[model samples]
Target: MKGILCTLLLLLWMITGCSNNSASNMENNKKLAEAVKQETEMPLEMPTDFNFMVSFGYGDVTKNVIDTYEGTVTKDLIIKGSATAEILFTADELRDIYDKMKTIDIMGPKELSKKGNCFQTPSNEDLWKVTVGGETKTFSWTDQKCGITEDANQLRELRNYIQHMVEGLEAYKTLPEAEGGYD
Candidate 1:
């Protein structure tokens, strides 16, 4: 009878351990799912009339702000337009492009341009090369050890940056309209 009880107890313990592990795994999976959903839901907004330059290189990431300096070309008058926030990136981010050029082999030379606005390349490889206005910038992987590794943190940062630019552009677009003119 003692032997039977001991065996039964051991079996119960093993079952409990397995169940706990499964529960932990399920929790982790749920968290991951939520994170992914949030990321996907993040919006990428761009201005109606602006450009952004981003660079993801080994040195520094650079984002050049570019905008059309519109001027009213009347019969004999030229009025300078206002400045707007184009796009922003760092130089280091641009350099990363060369480091992982191999992964971008599938990309074509067709520039990702938008009508009357800016351009943003689709996420490819581990790099993000985007252009706004007439300027261009790059975004490369920071963690070399995780190169090619689709880490959630890296993705989140990239997404945040893009989203930020979108918001800036959106705000910029409204500025001129609100003033009823760009002077």
Candidate 2:
């Protein structure tokens, strides 16, 4: 009887341990699935008609120009938009532009020089700016006829696109050399 009782207790303990491990694995799998889903849901391409303008001012001369640029939100990073200008700069140029624009240095009104991620004028005009190399550019609604609120949705989308691009670039930089391989 004693032998039988001891064997039965041991079996029960083993079964409970197995069950606990199974539960833990299931929980881990669930978390992993959620992470994967979130990553996969990120759009791989930027939405159509993602247009923004960049205006530059030097002393008394201020030039406002418009560029129809496209963007992509890849699993690795987000690309807001690229200019159609003939001047082609490498990836480094793009990164420099991104870094400069992420802050509100030359975008804000002349009165308020405070730095920010995005800038807004007193007239409720919102502008996004970026600097490449030493040149600073500002982007705002060119029409000047339509209010910023009119394109609020589009601006919001652009903001999200920028965020994703920044995150992707950061992730790519941290990846191991073996994973990226020689390109």
Best by lDDT: 2
The local distance difference test score of model 1 is: 0.39
- Each prediction's Cα RMSD? 17.2, 19.9
* Error at 64, model 2, angstroms: 41
Q: Candidate 2 residues 14-102, lDDT tens each?
A: 99999999999999999997776554332233222223343322222222122224232212111222122222223654544444433
Shift in Å, residue 78, candidate 1 = 35
- Estimate the TM-score of every prediction: 0.28, 0.26
Q: Clashes in candidate 1: how many?
A: 33
lDDT of 1 at 130: 47
